[model samples]
Target: MTTALKLVIFDVDGTLVDSQGDIVAAMAHAFDRAGHPAPAREATLGIVGLSLDAAFPRLAPELPAEMHGAMVEWYKEAYVELRSRAGAAASSPLYPYALETLTALHAQPETLLGVATGKSRRGLDKLFEAHDLGRFFVTSQVADHHPSKPHPAMLRAALAETGVEAHDAVMIGDTTYDRDMALAAGVPFIGVSWGYHDADDLTGAAAILRDFRELPEVLTTIREAAA
Candidate 1:
């Protein structure tokens, strides 16, 4: 039986947008400014679901534990500057049919939609407003209060704000961190294969979708099973 899901919480970075280029570039600058050699852009891209603060540890494994905070601070400053000028949303563009899929989901009366993303509230606001997609989400869980991916805080908070139960909620994300969080939260996960993380990272997801157009049917299957 497919899980009946009332709420669909999406992770912003890999799930909604292919934010690798901007994120990698920004992190490169941050690492350089911190006097650490920049890692490969692909390496930086792998941590897309993580918060700026959360991403620090992944990239700076050799940095002293105490230096993590300082590194995060510097990264934020550098990334913010990049976000203001040019971000991934500006470069890579949304996955094909991404907006159309969101529109279809929004039209479903039974579907309560929101975001659970590593993006800062301000940053996501800017991106969504630019794309005119901000109004679709009833509420958003930004990186501010939430612990990084693999932590369910963002999903929990978003669900709380929407008054949705974990059993009735599903998290749609493109990375393992995102799926891991959903698994930890006991919510069904919908893995999107087209994002920054490869298919391997989405192993825990209940199912995978090749395209956004498949989502409405997926939701329908879940709802029918839930019924």
Candidate 2:
């Protein structure tokens, strides 16, 4: 019998890439430019999977609501500047084994890779270009066209774009938002320990990976169980 195709969706920041340095630096720049104190690094990282509008409100609830739009723009400008200065690859390097795992998975005929990220299209494009990762993904969903994560819209779009059923797909991420988003989408979730969120917080994940090298085996196990 032919094996059913599997869709593996990934969250970009924290999961695939270690972008915390640039993220924190950009947040500080935005807050400084906006004449507000920067949020604690922990507070900023806690909102990694959220869109800029959603993130600013959480990070600085004391700021007036009307100022969020400008802050978002400022953050975008700061992030772009940082990427340009440091180069995107240096600003947000991939985690160890990330490229190898992606290459291995992309070689599989019965598997498809995709991205469902809170990152804007422009940001995602820069990362892909810097890392030469654009070819690996079959579907890419960004916050520019969807509601913030934990709302299920991005993953749902990924599924529709790939024509993959929820049952045959899995989400790998490093945050509670990703876990919650996968749950809301009725897809299995795999958490990563190396990302921003504490591993203990990934409450409902089907499995949590400590190393990217373990991913192929985990995917195989999930597929076998479903079969």
Candidate 3:
């Protein structure tokens, strides 16, 4: 009767942090520095969890290849500025009880934890260090090298890095892209209600969690089922 899940992967931005203000502000700065007008919040929000290659084209349409590179760099610079401004406060503080929940999960033996995020490696690294969460994860797949959410490349990378099979893993995310990636990978998903994606998009999730407080319990059931 034991379920077989052994590894857990999490999406960063909206799933882990409410990085909206900084993201919107920095994206706007990128456009400004590139001399293109800033895209509105709606458009930026729509592109939040996509890979840079995918997101940039959406953010800076019709630009030459060189300009696309420049705009991406511009975005990085602006994001850094934004991250710096938020300093330690930038991370979407885990939804209520998130830390307590993660701590409980980490205490269980044989469980490997990892990150699958749309954030750049540098960005995720900074946030991890700032939050003193650097030790919790074994694998980190950033947007720099992966295809992005809804694509499953990052999720696949994380699984490969951790040496876990899709059937033996679970992905927790806040967007449909994350959930879809999980499904595509043949892994179960735990969709978060408070993240940027709409709840209606959570229809495909294995289960939907209303808050971080529910995480430990939800995961425990999954783990037990897989046991």
Candidate 4:
């Protein structure tokens, strides 16, 4: 019997790349440019998987709604400047074992890789280009084109684009938003402990991975159980 294809979707921030330094810095710069205090580092990290519009409100609920748009633009500008100054690869290095795991999965003919990220398309493209990651993902759904994460829109779009059923797909991410998004889309979720969120908050994940090297075995387990 022919094996059914499996789709593996990854979240960019916190999961694939350790981008907290740049994220926190850009957020601070934006808040400073807006003449407001930056949110706490932990607070900013907590909202890592959300779109800028959704994220700014959570970080600064006291700000008038009208100011949020300008803040988003400021953050984007600061982020771009920081990436340019630090060099793309240095600003957002992939997590340990991430490249190896991606290579292994890409080699498996029955498995297809995709991305469902809170990063804008331009940001994701930059990271992919910097890391030579454009070849690994067959489909990439970005916040620029879809609703912020935890809404399931990105995952649903990935499923449609790849022609993979929800049950045959898995989402690997580091935040509660990722878990909830996968749940909303009826896809299995694997949480990574190394990301921005605390591991305890990743409740209800099918599995939690402390290292990316464990991903292949975990995927095998999920796939067999689904079969």
RMSD of each: 2.9, 0.8, 2.4, 0.7
Compared with the true structure, what per-residue lDDT tens digits does model 1 show for residues 123-216? 7887787678887888788888777878988878877788789878888988888889999988899999888788875776777989899988
The candidate maximizing TM-score is: 4
Give each model's whole-structure lDDT: 0.80, 0.94, 0.79, 0.94
Report clash pairs, candidate 3.
2-226, 2-227, 3-225, 3-226, 3-227, 4-226, 17-92, 18-92
Error (Å) of candidate 4 at residue 99 is 0.3
Q: Put down candidate 4 lDDT per residue, 5-103, tens digits, no spaces.
A: 889999999999998999999999989988998899999999999999999999999999889889999999999999999888999999999999999
**12 Cα displacement, candidate 2 (Å):** 0.3
Question: Candidate 1: which pairs clash?
Answer: none
Rank all candidate structures by their lDDT, best first, as comma-separated numbers: 4, 2, 1, 3
After superposition, which runs of candidate 3 have C-alpha atoms over 4 Å from their true positions? 1-5, 90-92, 223-227
| lDDT computed for candidate 4 | 0.94
List TM-score per model, in order: 0.90, 0.98, 0.89, 0.99
Worst 10 contiguous positions by lDDT, candidate 1: 83-92
- Residue 225 miss distance in model 1 (angstroms): 2.5
Q: What C-alpha lDDT does candidate 1 achieve relative to the native structure?
A: 0.80
